[model samples]
Target: MRKVVKYLIVLVVFFMIPICILAHPGRLDANGCHTCRTNCAQYGLQDGQYHCHNGNSSSSSNSSSSNNSYNNVTTRKTTTTRKTTTTTKKQVYGCMDSSAINYNVDATNKDGSCQYEKTETKTEDINYDTKIKGNLKEGNKTVIEEGQKGQKEVTIKSVVDEDGNEISSEVVSEKIIKDPVDEVVEYEEEMSDSEALTILIIYVLNIILVMFYSKKNKNSKLIINYVRRIKIRIIKYIIYIIYFVYVIPVFIDVILVIIDFVKRKLKK
Candidate 1:
């Protein structure tokens, strides 16, 4: 019984495992599919943050001749400034779940960290389990067998990670079967009609004798005789009933006898 409960637990774990994986908030999906997905204002895929700026620039010019042709004096001034900055970032996602449990270690990130979001969907198909209920004739195996004996057909599925740890499970279908029990039969030797009548008459006489003797005599010897007669009559009645009602029709006992007879003949 304890073992049966364990199998059910394993099966249930298989089915429910997918749900558990889906239920949790997935690993942070900061890394969007940026290749085709053009870079947004806040972030860019191909090129990271880029900035360029110029502070300010000014110029002035004036001139005066040595011969004093021009009365006013001239002056010149010039200024230049500039600013620039750049940044790059990458992400990866897909087969190898960074956050998921370890199962397969062979997967890799194709190009740098190509950030990806996990979108899981369930797949339905057959799974192998040896535990099944039924008459394990030779090769047959069973999962649960205590409540009743039978050939129970069951459909079970479980969800697990790459490794075979039980996560969640469900029953696709089930059938309860009852094993047929052979009735225990007692066989007695058949008797002739004369033998039957003889016992019947003896039973009646014993009853009468016991009652009448008890009424007349308080003697121990007579009581013992009455009991002995009753024992004999009971043994005969049992033989008649067992032979007619049980042993003959059941056939198992008769088969055993036939087999023994065949064995004897073969030896001869």
Candidate 2:
């Protein structure tokens, strides 16, 4: 019985040794190849390293996705901030009237830009004509009054450039110094023919009457010589007195009337 048990034990040991060798077929080296141990090769390798690549790659992809999402969010925020920070400049335009000499018709706004030309003034003397007042006969003139020239003050306005050239000028105001006086004159007129004839007839009649009276007195027969002589003297004296009193005044009046008429005609 002991011999038989020994043989059976040896056969059992030999069968167990073949089964172990069949289970592990590869040798142990740097490739990390294993006969009985399962390694990273079952999960796949990364950059030639023995590691659980599936888990690392999956975790890395998730992390990268998270990082990309975070980066996208940050980039979008930065772009929006930049857009909000930027600004545009404003533009303005207008016209300035204070410095300009002439009025501008087209400018819509005032910018305080304007230009002006130079200006000047001048003065001069003036003479005025005389005015006539009274009358004189045709073809006759006399200065009843004298005339004198008057003076005037004048102001001139002018625009000049920087070159000392005149642009334009105008009168600003005028004044008087002394007014002139007008002259007056007059002349006489001749008496009419009818008026002369009437005076002559009256003079001749008076002469005839005086002569007749004297002769009558000289030839008187009834009166005494002394009485006749006295009467004759008295008569002659009365005749002379009447002629002087009436005729002299009438002649003076006629002369005055003629002068007045001539003056009035000249006035007209």
RMSD of 2: 21.4
Model 2 scores worst on lDDT over the 10 consecutive residues at: 69-78
Clash list (residue pairs), candidate 2: 95-111, 99-114, 99-115, 100-114, 100-115, 144-184
Report the number of backbone clashes for model 1. Answer: 26
Question: How does each model score on TM-score?
Answer: 0.19, 0.26
Weakest 10 consecutive residues of candidate 1 by summed lDDT = 49-58
Q: Rate the local accuracy (lDDT) of all candidates.
A: 0.42, 0.48
Q: Report residue 213 deviation for candidate 1 (angstroms).
A: 8.8
Clashes of each: 26, 6
Report the alpha-carbon TM-score of model 1 versus the true structure: 0.19
The C-alpha stretches of model 1 lying farther than 4 A from their native spots are 1-148, 175-268
On residues 112-165, what C-alpha lDDT tens digit does candidate 1 reach at each position?
222322333343333323333333333222333223234555566655554445
- The per-residue C-alpha lDDT of model 1 at residue 227 equals 56
